[model samples]
Target: MNITVKFFSSLMEYLPRSVEGNAMAVQVDPGTSPRQILARYRVPDEEVRTVMRNGVFLPEEDRDQPLEEGDVLTVWPSIQGG
Candidate 1:
């Protein structure tokens, strides 16, 4: 299946070269979890401060849930402003 992964803030650095605008469309196997995808991309656990699927918030524990086709997984990092 195909899914969209988006990295926000400082997390954009982790996106692959093929990805543009902090987002990418990639292929994933059936039953693949968001956690697995993050691991595959080597996204640090601490770097992912937030996770949203299709505009809905996804708690840390729910990252293990399988993603469906066309699902948009948006992840953000903790940011501090002075």
Candidate 2:
């Protein structure tokens, strides 16, 4: 199956160099979870402050859920403002 993964803010550094932008199309086996992708990219759990799937916020508990084909998994790093 294929899905799109997007990293925002500082998390964008984790994206593959081949990826032109913050998003990349990736191939995954069936039942692949967002957590798996994060781990694959070496994205630290503490760095991930938000996770969205297809524009909807994905709760931490639900991140283990299997991702369907064409799903968009977006991640954002922790942000700080003065």
Candidate 3:
């Protein structure tokens, strides 16, 4: 299945060079989970502060849920401002 993975803020640096923009196309198994995609980019759990599937917020626990074809996974890191 094909999925679109998007990185925001500091997380954008993690995207592969082939991904010219903030979003990239990836191919995964039928049962691929959000966590697996994070792993693919070597994004640490702590660095993944927010996750969304097709604009729907995905709670941490639900990240393991299987992602469907054409799904768009957006992730961001924790932002701090003083």
Candidate 4:
């Protein structure tokens, strides 16, 4: 299966340098979870503040759910601004 992963804000640094922009397309076996994808990319769990699958918010518990083909998993880090 194939899916698109997007990292936002400071979290974008976690993505590979070859990845253009903030998103990358990846191939994974069936039942691959968002958590596993983050781990594969060495994205620290603490750095992720939000997870969205195809524009729907995914709660922490649901992050481990299997991602379907063509799903877009977007993550964002905690942002601070005055």
lDDT of each: 0.90, 0.94, 0.93, 0.94
Q: Give the alpha carbon lDDT tens digit for every residue of 1-82 in model 2.
A: 9999999989989988888989999999999999999999999999999899999999999999999999999999875689
**Model 2 error, position 3 (Å):** 0.2
> What does candidate 3's lDDT look like per residue over 1-82, in tens digits?
9999999999988999778879988899999999999999998888899899999989988999999999999999985689
Give each model's clash number.
0, 0, 0, 0
Give Cα distance to truth, residue 74, candidate 2, Å: 0.3
**Model 1 RMSD, rounded to 1 decimal:** 1.9
Please tell me which model should have the higher TM-score, number 1 or number 2. 2
What TM-score would you give candidate 4 relative to the actual structure?
0.93
Q: List the residue pairs that clash in candidate 3.
A: none
Q: Which stretches of candidate 3 lie over 4 Å from their true place?
A: 79-82
lDDT value for model 1: 0.90
In TM-score terms, candidate 2 sits at 0.93
**Prediction 4 global C-alpha lDDT:** 0.94
Candidate 2 lDDT for residue 23: 92
RMSD of 2: 1.8
lDDT of 4 at 7: 96
